[model samples]
Target chain A: MATQQTQLLARTLLTPAVALLFIWMIVPLALTIYFATLHYNLLDPGSESFVGLENFRYFLTDPAFLASLQNTLVLVGSVLAITILLGVPLALLLDQQVVGLSIVRLMVIAPFFVMPTVSALVWKNLLMHPVSGLFAWIAHLFGLPAIDWFNDAPLFSVILIISWQWLPFATLILLTALQSLDEEQKEAAEMDGASALSAFIYITLPHLARPITVVILIETIFLLTVFAEIFVTTGGGPGLQTTNIAFLIYSQALIQYDVGSASAGGLVAVVLANIVAFFLVRIVGRNLEA
Target chain B: MARMVTTRHKVISTVAAWLVGFLIFFPILWMVLASFKTELEAFAIPPSFLFFHWTTENYVTVQERSDYLHHALNSIIIAGGSTLIAMLIAIPAAWSMAFSPTKRTKDVLLWMLSTKMMPPVGVLVPIYLIYRNLGLLDTRTGLVFILCLGNLPIVIWMLFTYFKEIPKDILEAARMDGATIGRELIYVLTPMAVPGLASTLLLNLILAWNEAFWTLNLSTLEAAPLTVFIASYSSPEGLFWAKLSAASTLAIAPILVLGWFSQRQLVRGLTFGAVK
Candidate 1:
């Protein structure tokens, strides 16, 4: 029995975290919402005025906003697709009986640990550089021209780098989920004349559904705000080719010093992320209840 | 079914998996190898895979050139300080929720998880202004405070999950023996919580170390962590492939090792125990 004394003590213990998180969540956000309504530019200070809905209107109407919005969706959608699609097969393969599984796993998952900047730059210079990158050499080996990655397809390049960073994460989670699958169930499927492909499609896919949702939601949360990789690789460069909402807001706030519009964009980002978080919290909460 | 797959099938699967693994890992591997090469060799067309003139010069140069150690120290201070502070605030809270969960415990935990979903960009403008006005910009304390708050939810959540798994019978038994609450925690609870605490620390440290948004926005040169420092190399310095590789390698090596060690915990931590 949880004594009343212990419950009191527990509430006391929880207060600091609760109080701090409450402030952490509410204070800046309240400020952001407040700032979103004003025509405040940092460089032209002391002329702040309430310009209700103007910032949001401008932020929403700006062509760059539309481009960055599209870019954000593409970045998130592509990385999610790439990671999940490849991750499933990779997880299945790793789940198979294999030699040096530990070493293979370490090598496979190594990229997930690499810092975003490092992975982005490494892929940019050493692997994808059109001039002297490894891909150039590989292209030369086949007597084909080197396709400039960042220059030609900056958004795709960003997507590739992010997908690489996240694929390992997807695989590791799915593999962990896979290892817990009922071997008896698999054997039964096999005995019932299910081929490997059918067993995987019918049994394995169903088994992976929850973890797949977990991976997608978790990855979407991170992917939607992907910053460092784009920052290092493209700097949202070549005229907003790779600019996502995060970078767009950063440039607006810190670069252009437009507090009002940046705050508006920030709110927009908050709303977008909350849409995803709504589903994620529900799913994770369901798991908690279970 | 396991026996139905022949040795040949096993061998084929092994080869394919290893190839895929190596392909996935090639970028990091190439970076490491490039770190050991002469700058010219690092960028040579028809690149030398293994026979390049190996050098430790890039590692020496990366430090001597950019003061790599300074940024690395900032990373350590920021990541370590945040994780430490987070754990201190989180431990008791997680302990309470685990041991004496009330009707609101689940709601509280879910609410904490929701805070993590608040995109950092949403609050970036205000936080930036707040830091500027308070003159906390480019300070380790600023970075540490933000990162600690940013990660506090996950720290509490992960610790809660771990602490929940800890059997309450032991605590009840200690209570039945007339042990005081403090003594019960000291003598009965902490030892069991160590593994969970360590893994949580490791995971949080890794997350904080690689954290980019706040560190990038709030700090410049003085408190710049490796993330910001490495981002500086994105321009002219990035063209120097070997040096870039050396800097990147050094920046990631510690977190990589820590990450590998904590990989198991990572799934639980990142997924908020949804997968587990």
Candidate 2:
């Protein structure tokens, strides 16, 4: 009897959130679909007319679309790989008993807290400045010529900045997973004379499988939409070398004010993000349930 | 002998870990140091580490050139207000989902999360139009509402985890003693889950605070947060390294200090169930 009452309350309480989320989804898609089918613009309503699939065709055919799409994939995939590679080892290191580990943990996580805009500026100006930046100074001291990071290696530079910020998150999540590993299982492996690397490979790696997926899925979702780094350092340039889909959409929506093309691009980004989310739901959604 | 070798190994690991820690932290350290340098010293080709002439001129210029305080206030108001409002809505929602069991509950949770998966750009048109229609452009209230909406699913998910760890029988006993639903949520559930809720609040504030895309797009001048404040430093007049660092330092100092104080709670909350 009490369960029924609680269930009814649950339904009532969730009604508003569920309804609002639904509206948020439907209204946006409806407007996007409408815009995609027309030449809608904030500047000129008089020129509006039905031009079905032209915007889509133009967007799909544009080289900018494919370039940004490829860049987006590379950006997301590369960051995911770097963060995991760096994060897992860092997690293992931190999980071990160490003096000043707390302080070290604090230092590592500090990058994640810095606002993206500020960090991007810091990197672009202070660390990647070919003449005046730290990397330049280091190179000069080693008798090597300085590399202009943004001009020469825009994508790689942006990836480095992003990976620096996100590595802390991966580390913390995986470290938490590491700490939760069964002590007995580890001890059993040790008693069997298993090397530390082998133990980590067999036992610890499997334990972290879920979190690694989560770290990738969550990071991929954000990375596909990386903007602040691009906005600050490269502006998706050195001739559109670093433009991701999100930046591409922003240029269409705001820079060009081509709402029709922008909406179509936005819809494409949504479809791609949802595919990743579907996989994430299979992993993380089950964890939430458990 | 074996114990002594193990002790030696622990020492080596500690030293190695601290070195890695210093390397990771060196960039922010460089920025802060740059903020104190004169522009010439800041832009020195060799990148002055400690031998540079230090000055407060960049900070002074940053203050004179930009409305730093106004942007800081906006960052606080928007991030704090949004997270507070999200907590208000999410707590009750999480409570219901946590204490109540249903076949559809997991589906509901996943659905809420699916909304997060939708890229913000996808809905920029409709949202922008709606904001323009409602006169919410460049307004704190609009930014707060959107930010709150954006983080609500994560808020509920985190709160649900925290509340689930709490045994439901304790709340039931409160009900048996004639505690109303309101009394149960406010008096019983909240206090018990304070740590979890606190971290949820902290993490949400951090997420909202670092948010750049919405804060940048939605607000040009009036509602621009610290992200915009930092972005303003970029212009065609050649980049000013010292001044930019000062601006960046001012933008991040408050949140960074807060994170330092609450690192333990933040880590614990984030890793809540993932490890265990």
Candidate 3:
């Protein structure tokens, strides 16, 4: 009876958080869905009417939607590839007995903490500006023409800035995974006359596999909705060159005040994100057991 | 277990690692240096690495022009307020789940995690409309509420992970000694949970501080935080590099320090204990 009472108390304790989260998750989502089907525009309030699937049709057929969709994929894919590629080697290097390991680690991780707006502005104005930027200065020394980063290649510049922010996350997680690897296993491989490269391929790489997947999934979740960097630097512009789905929806709602179509675009983003989240939740769920 | 390696190899690895570290850190270092330079010198050709005539004029000008302290204070309140509120709700939920876990506990936890996966953009339209109708747009209260909900899952999950590690034996011992539930919590659990609580607070504060999307979308001048403050510099009109750098530096410096201290908690909180 005492245990039963405690269990009831436990249920009571859990209710507030559960109720709040449920309301938070469901209400806005339901409204978004409801509005997606209406002819709602902030600019033309009190005129909302049922227009089933019209917003979706318009959003889907729009040229900007296709371009933004493509940009979204490329942005997520390229940033993931760059971070993981650089991160693996960086993690291995940090895992070694390097001099001043803490300082070096801190330096590498510093970029991750810089706010997206600061990093984006710093990159655009101080580093990537064609004539007065650091890259231009460097090019001048090398006798090469300066490339206007935002204009010449907008998407790639966004990727580079984002990759810098996320590289530390991947590296830090991979390093944690690396630190947990058993020394005896590597020693055993050495005893068996296995080459260093072969041992890494067989043992080390396998240990990092799970962390790498976790990194990829988590990064994908954030990367799909990269907003501030694009907002600050490119404004999704020089033509929809850098406008990922998040920026597209942002522009649609705030810039153009088209709530119905933006809601439709928002749903498309949700579906895309959910596909990634499904895999991520499964991975995290399995890890919960361990 | 120590493995023997040649001094030469170690030296080579150190050099290579530092080089990579410096390359990664250069942008932030450059920004900091640029903040101290004159407007004319900030955009100097050949980009003065360390030899620039340093000045505090940019910092002064940035503060004077934009009222940097006002937005900064907003950042503090919003980030701090949201984190405190989230912790308040999350602690009891996490405590119950951690200590008195039932058959459905795992599912409940996973479901909370799933809510985090719901993209903010998915609800952007409704939130905007709701805030507009309620006249809550450009209010710190609105941003705080949204940010709190946004981070509550991670806060609860982190607290759950921490609370679960506290041995149940202690609580049972206190119960046998005739301690009431309230007394048991105050006397026994609170002391053990303090460090975990501190780290969780630090990590959540950092996350909330750097949260840009909602803050950007929902806020304008009245309640704008550092993210919006820095973004206002995007439009180029004149020699604004030094001033922009000054604002950016001020915006990031506090959180960057907090972030460094909470690096371990960050990995665990963000990865949901998958990596750690």
Candidate 4:
């Protein structure tokens, strides 16, 4: 009796949000599918024609479409790898009982809260400018030529900036996980004459598995759809070198005025994201309980 | 020999820690410094750390170049308004799930989280159409509604974790005192959960403030916030380093101050569910 009542109450409480999101999901998707089969362009609004799967066929075969899919994967993968590698070491340092550690923590987390566009702009202009940026300044200081980060290396530059911002999140979570490690266990390990490196390998690394997974999953979801960095840094280019899937879709709809193709592309991106999200759901669901 | 090695290890770790911390913070520090430089001095080779001529000309130029105050105000309104709205709805919902949860409550929570995992671009087309059709494009109201709805799940999750620790018997006692549901929520639950709520609010406000995607995509002139304001420095011709820094410094200043003041609460809030 209690179980049934709670289920009903749960449904009642969750219904509003679930229903709203369901509509939010279904309505766009329905339009995209409907539009995909019909000829629709923002430029040619009055002319409507049923064209089944032609948009998808066009999008799939488009060279830019293929480049965008590859770009999205590269961006997400590189950011994930860099954040974990940098973040784990950073987390270990922040976990130390150093003086002024509190201030250090705040400084570390400051970047994560900077608006993405702002960060990208800062990186592009102040840091990465070939002639005038601090990077240019530094290379001159060392008597070397400056490299144009956005022009020559737009994708890597985006990856680097995004990882820099997200590094703190992974670090903070890992720091929390590190702090929760039992002092007694560490003391026993020390007493047994285990080296610090070995102790981390045997004990601390295992403890951090969950947080590491959480960081990767959460960051992946955000990174796959990263827009502002490219939007600000290179506008996804020195000619599509940095255009990820999200940027590709935005450019199609807003810049190219191809609503049908963009909708078809959006649906494809959604399906790919769902496949990634299905795994994320399993990982996140195992931990969250009321 | 062992003691000497330990001392060396300590020194090495301290140096490494400070070096990494400084690197992580260098971009922001560079922006602040660049904000005070003249455009020519800002571009100087061998980067004048302190020897360059100092001027607030860039800041002045930035202020005169754009509507600084208006973008700042738009940012404050959208971030503060969305966070406030999210909190107001989430608190009650989180309370119900935490204290009076039914068998399906966990499933509901999981489902909410799953929505967050879906790529935002997936729904962009339809939402654009919705906003366009409803005349909500480039409006603060539109931005506020989307942000609140977008972040509701996170707000609820954070509050639910905090609310779980409160004894159910306390609310029961308030009920015995003939306090109404609203009174119990406002006076009883709100007070008891103050730390949790305050931290949640602050974090959400920061997150909302920094959200760039939807704000940029949906907004132009009248509704565009600081993110767009900063992005404007990025031109198709090339970037202006000094001016961009000026805009970035202006954009991040308020949130950095908020973050400095609320460090402890932010730390505690971030660590709440993860540590457990």
Best by DockQ: 1
Relative to the true structure, how large is the alpha-carbon lDDT of every model?
0.94, 0.85, 0.93, 0.81
- The alpha-carbon deviation from the true structure for residue A56 of candidate 3, after best TM-score superposition, in angstroms, is 1.1
Q: On residues A5-34, what C-alpha lDDT tens digit does candidate 2 reach at each position?
A: 878998887777777777777888889888
Highest lDDT: give the candidate number.
1
Report the Cα lDDT for residue B240, model 1.
Answer: 90
> For each of the candidates, what fraction of the native contacts does it recover?
0.82, 0.71, 0.82, 0.54
lDDT of 3 by residue, A1-290 (tens): 87998999999999999999999988998888888999988788799899999999999999999999999999999999999999999999998879999999899999989989999999988989999999998999899999999999999999999999999999999999999999999989999999989998999999999999999999999999999999999999889999999999999999999999999999999999999989988988888887
Off by over 4 Å in 4: A1-19, B1-8, B176-180, B236-240, B260-276
What docking tier does model 1 reach?
Answer: high
lDDT of 1 by residue, A187-230 (tens): 99989999999999999999999999999999999988999898
Candidate 2 interface RMSD value = 2.0
Candidate 1 wrong stretches, greater than 4 Å: B1-4, B237-239
Candidate achieving higher DockQ, 1 or 3: 1
Off by over 4 Å in 2: A1-5, B236-239, B261-276
- CA lDDT, candidate 4, residue A54: 93
Q: Which portion of correct inter-chain contacts appears in model 2?
A: 0.71
Docking class of 2: medium
lDDT per residue (tens digit) for residues B1-276 in model 2: 999988998998899899999999988999999899887778777666788777888878887888778888999999999999888888778888888858988898878888888899888877887898999999999999999988888888888888788997898799889998888878987789998888889888988999988887888789998988788776632358888888888888889987776665555444334434
Tens digits of per-residue lDDT for model 3 on B108-165?
Answer: 9999998998888888889988999999899999999999999999999999999999
Per-residue lDDT tens digits for candidate 4, residues B191-240, read: 88998888889888988899888998999889989998887777743435
True contacts kept of 1: 0.82
- The better-scoring model by lDDT among 1 and 2 is 1
